[model samples]
Structures are given as C-alpha cells and as structure tokens.
Target: MITAVVGMAMAASGCSAPGPDPGGATATSPEPGKSISNAGETASWELLNAAEITPESTVLRLGVTRIECASGITGTVLEPEIQCDGEQIVIRTSVETPEPGDYSCPGNNMVPITVHLQSPVGQRQLFDAACLDAETLATAFCVDGGVRWRP
Candidate 1:
C-alpha cells in the first residue's frame, strides 16, 4: 500500500494541558526518538503520519495540541529532522510553539510541516520516529502504518 491513513481527529476534551515549554532544551540537535523540551516536566508529542510523500519530501498535518492534553505541539525552534539510514528513513519531530495565541483549547486546526530530503527517496522505507517513543506512541495520533511504505 502506498497510502498512509492518518488519524484525522485531534484529541482534546479532558486532554488539555499547559504547553510543556514553548522553548525546548538548549541542546543544539534533537536525538533520533525523543522530544527534548525545556528541562522541566517530561512532555512528549505524537507525530502525525506522512500526509504526503514525494521523492524529495514528506509532509505532516497536525494541530497545535496534537493529542490529548498535549501542548506546545508546534513551534519552530527546530525543524522536523529527517534521516535516511540506508534501509529506512527516520523522521523526528519536536514541539516549537508559535507566539502565544488562542489556537483553541484542544488546538485542532490542522497545520502542515514539511520535511525535505537531500536525495529522492527511491526505496528507503519511511518511518515516523514518534513510533519509537513509548509516551508518544501511546497518544492516539499514531496507529498502524508505522512504516509509510509497503510492498
């Protein structure tokens, strides 16, 4: 199958919490499977599956509150990191919130984040690093299709 069915609904209701830290850790770069936010409470976010993929890029659409009670879902401190390990492409995403605003309690307005690649993805598998995170994986945003491509 070439299409990945993304969870279209943003979780909210009894799941709204304060943003972890609009500002994340000062570590220059993020690791492969962790959301290193301000050294406070350990907050993690579930990554949306690839909504669109091309030879040169992968696109994800998610709300600011991503999942249940999940906050600080998007900022821009760091761009979504993309890595190709010969066999699979691993993508790691972090929460870098926007200027404080009312994006809605359960910020459910889907926005897009695109990750570009250096080379066209030929056969390398596509994986959402969020799946590697236990806390993030528990969030509803990630379901089946951890691997975006299947033969």
Candidate 2:
C-alpha cells in the first residue's frame, strides 16, 4: 500500500500473465552490476512484493505500480532482468516508455509482472535491485526483508 507524498500519488490494481512470447518468457542470470537483456533503454522499478507461483516453479509475479505516461502506448513493463548475487536471486524490472512527445497518461496503477526463470528458485533468496540502493533502501516501500524476500 502507498500513501500520498510529494508529486507521486499511485493507484493499485493489476493482473499477472506470461509475456507476449508464445514459447514462454526466458530470463538470464547475469552477474550483479551487469546489464541483462532488455528492450531499448529502460528505467528500473522496485517490486512492491513478489510470490513464487509454486515452490518448484521458477516463475514469479512481481508486484509493481505502473506509471502509464501515454494514452496510445501500452505494455509499459519491459522484460525483467535477473541477476545472481552470491546466495540471492536478484530480480530487476525495466520500465519501457515511448519517445518524448505530447502525451497524456492519467493513470498510475499496480501491475503484477510475470517472469520466467531458467532454474527453479528453490531456497535462493529474492532481492530487488531498485530497492537496494543505499539511499532509498531504508525509506523505500520495500517488503519486510529490506529489499530481500524469503519463501
């Protein structure tokens, strides 16, 4: 849940679904601080929360608040970038936006992004890189684990 503060006022609502790919989405486990594959240049979004569909499943539905910046443009969620930092599986979100121009985006709401991982998560800890920043980690509305989640 988010409260009004500053210039940001967010609405919460969403659904989880597989990516547009028919064969199912694929993810990469790049080293920390390295860029994982994504579309165009993107911005990072912190996870409001996350849940493993099943204990053995590698798929995750990452809770996020989407900021819709244009009326005609859709699919604001870019593919998620995955990373492995020691004993943790770092999940990062890349937000896609159209080129700057006259636009109207009246809604900012929550969306659960579904991602597919190559390996079963098992016991690995989950972390959100966007929330891991030293400056924001403490103040960021991250999960109870302080940017990390345990199943």
Candidate 3:
C-alpha cells in the first residue's frame, strides 16, 4: 500500500508541465551579430543618440532604465556600428553636436549609454515603450510575441 501511494504521488508531480523558458522571456537577435529571424521576418533596430540627434532626428533619450522581457518573446539590439565590449553596449555622445545644424544646443557633452535590450517584440509588451508618431507604421510585432516595434 505504501509503495503504491508513493508511485502515485510521483506520477502526479511528473505530470505537471514545465513552468517556462527563462530564455524565451526576453527577445534577442541571432548569435552572430546579424539580423534575427523570427515570426517569419528579419528584425533589427537603430540606436540614435542625443549627441547624434539632429533637428530632423526623431529619437530622444527616455532616461536611463533597465528593461526586462515580460513573457512569450525574445529579441536583441542589432547595433553594428557601436562595439559591445564585454557585457556592455557602449553609447558615446559629445556635448558638441557631431555636425552643424544638429540642434540648437548650449552644452554639447559626452554621455555614455548602455542598454539592457530585448527584441522589439519583447520590449513593446514588457514596457509601454514604442515609436511615437509616423514611425509606428514601419514597426511590427510578432503576433505571438508581446509587441516589437522599430524605432
């Protein structure tokens, strides 16, 4: 009787499904530093900094914050120009604008930036972050993933 009860308990516990894949919680790109294939499409994003920000630039800093993937998605920031040294994605900005007519600014200062990134799809669902205005039209999210937007 005791052996039968133990076997039944073990079976019941084993029948439960696996909780979740922590890896899938965040959206990341391919391992080789190239476009990632997901949801039947290739995905990538451009990191525009404040120093490089021009009058026509649409991107602006949203304050420094660490973002985590909520669930059911994963992605990465595909920044080829900036080098990711060690575990850091370094962003450099100078007080002086990179070019003339960049913006009407008094102080051009250098700022270092690092991002805790997931795929666009992961970020969209995790945070209320998204591209504002007409940029939305060009962005897309996987139906299964949260909300991946291109900014």
Candidate 4:
C-alpha cells in the first residue's frame, strides 16, 4: 500500500512539470536598434506632420513608420522630391494670378485651401485650412486616386 501511494504521488508530481513554451525563443523581443523580419511582409508609410500649402508653395511632411521590404530596408523619411514618385504629389513655387482689373474679388480676400492625401491604405486631408475660397484658392492633393478631408 505504501509503495502504491508513493507511485501515485510521483505520477501526480510529474504531471505538474512545466510544459513546452507556446511562444518559444523566437517570441522574445529584439534588442534596441535591432529588428525582426518575416517572409511575405509589406512596408507601410506614416505621415508625421500635416501637409501645408501656400499660394507660393506646397509642403508635405512624411515618414516611413513600418517596413517589411524584400531589400531588408527599414522605415525612413523619403526625400521631398522622391516622395511617391511625384505621381501622387505636386508642388508649385509660383502661382499665376489674374490682373488687378480682371476680377472684382479683393486681394485681401484670401481664401483658405485644404489639400487631401490618398494612399494605398486610406485617405487623409492636410492640415486645416486657414481660409477657403472655391474660385481662386481651390487646391487639392489626390493620391492613389483617393480624396482626404477631415470635415
């Protein structure tokens, strides 16, 4: 009887031993400045700042927040000129305006314009416009054929 009881206790204790880890060693977090990669993953871009456009110039602030490219590249900020291959963004330094006598609208009547940004994921509008007027200051940014606007 004693031997049987001892055997049962040993069996019960063995059942309580730790099992295999579900996450495994690969689940551990990477060290600082290091990264992990998996196959067939895609990269993503993140806009850091709202785009700002003026009568004389247009500006966009953007950065890459996630990357899973074939080249093993990481997320980064793209140069202003190289953004989206120039297809999605357009900037003009000088704007042509009508002559003083061409329109009755006052020069001080500056209309605020808001631009929208489009991407593979979704659409987002630029920063809120200071002012907006449809006739003269109507400008928009169409990316990937999508429109972006907050309100």
Candidate 2 off by > 4 Å: 1-55, 66-75, 98-107, 143-148
Residue 133 Cα positional deviation in candidate 1, in Å, after optimal superposition: 1.0
The sequence of per-residue lDDT tens digits that candidate 4 reaches over residues 1-109 is 0000001111221211122222342222112222222222222222333343332222233332212111222322222111121112211111122233432322121
Ranking by TM-score: 2, 1, 4, 3
lDDT by candidate, in order shown: 0.40, 0.46, 0.23, 0.22
lDDT of 2: 0.46
Q: How close is every model to the real structure, measured as TM-score?
A: 0.47, 0.51, 0.16, 0.20
What TM-score would you give candidate 1 relative to the actual structure? 0.47
lDDT at position 117, candidate 4? 27
TM-score of structure candidate 2: 0.51
Ranking of models by lDDT: 2, 1, 3, 4
Query: lDDT per residue, candidate 3, 40-105, as tens digits?
Result: 212222232435433232233322211222121212222212212112122211111122233332
Candidate 1 residue 35 Cα shift, in angstroms, is 7.1
After superposition, candidate 3 runs with Cα above 4 Å error: 1-97, 101-124, 127-130, 139-146, 149-151
lDDT of 1 at 80: 44
Q: Pick the candidate with the highest TM-score.
A: 2
- Tens-place lDDT per residue, model 1, 26-63, is 21222435542222222223335444544444334322
